[model samples]
Target: MLWLSCVDETAPALPAAWLIATDAQPANLPERSALRRSLACKVLARQFGLPDAAVEIGHEPAGRPLILAPQGSGLHLSLATRSGLVAIALAPRPVGVDVEQVAPASEPPLAMLHPEERRWLASLPASARPETFAQLWSAKEAYVKALGIGFARAPESFAVRLDGAGRFVVDGARNGGPASGFVRLTKNGGHESMAAAFIVLDQA
Candidate 1:
């Protein structure tokens, strides 16, 4: 199953189980993202009828969080957050998700894009580039994370095609597999376009 959750980062009310799960996570962890992840696990476990305590969270050497409870269950999940929004994807196979918010003043490194991607962006008007950059970047990140290698898996090693607005298809993967996405223009404070990508990898 696939799930996407938009958690309000305003310290909103949480279920008692989730609160305990969140508190059980390491304190003074330094990154607020970690807390959000813990909460995400609790939320996901609830949906699966697994008690929060039955879930054990560990980490890969590459720093990716490993959901360690109920071993051999063949379940996997991924989480992403940005600007007070948390996105999660759950699947029976490996999965990855990414949330990217556009900023007009953004200056992204060109090295992140493959040559074909660079050309695609160059073809767009300057006004379209920033959000497109975020969209493309998020898709690549999502794909690599789904592979469970994180950034250690080179995103540029494969290719992804942006199929118009808010859609991505993995170009080089077997028969061009598709990745799901959600995109919208937000006027929260300033005009910005944000996107979320959910990716499932090819079987090993």
Candidate 2:
């Protein structure tokens, strides 16, 4: 399951399956890195019933976080941080999570989106474009991260759209196969909100 919380809140309790958490954005680069590892360790500790110090995090050549000490844990995770929030996801299989502040963009970056996604956003009312753009971007980020490729695969190479059931769906040719995820708006405070997405790919 996915979970969301603030950085100031107590460390989140882990679930038996997948887990996602969001918190207040740390103030600097060092803090961000530390927070990401801290959260990852916490999740690993609880999920595997191990001590926090026993769970170590390293980075793959592609910058994906890896479990260094627990040799055969069979786990995967991804992290994202934006203007006012930071997010992390942990899963028994590969998983990705992204969170971004929801703010209007006077000039939405249509060129970065897949053609079908661009057209879908164009079909929405002007007032709805900003949030829709956030949703699409977050979903795209989450999907690529799950693939462990990041932007090595172009953002415009795939499409993210809301289906009739209002669930986020991804399509287009990509290295990873058979993925699933969701994008949703999260209220952070009185006037601030965020868009977050969590994606998991099928085991090979």
TM-score of each: 0.73, 0.81
Where does the lowest 10-residue lDDT sum fall in candidate 1?
Answer: 14-23
Candidate 2 local lDDT, residue 60: 90
C-alpha positional error of residue 60 in candidate 1 after TM-score superposition, expressed in Å: 2.3
Per residue, candidate 1 scores C-alpha lDDT tens digits across 92-147 of: 66677776777668665557788888888888888888888887887888777777
lDDT of 2 by residue, 23-70 (tens): 455689778778667866776676567788998999999988888867
Model 1 residue runs over 4 Å out of place are 1-3, 6-29, 174-193
Clashing pairs in 1: none
lDDT of 2 at 19: 27
Separately for all candidates shown, the number of backbone clashes (residues 3 or more apart, or on different chains) is: 0, 0
For candidate 2, give the lDDT of residue 167.
Answer: 54
Highest TM-score against the true fold, candidate: 2
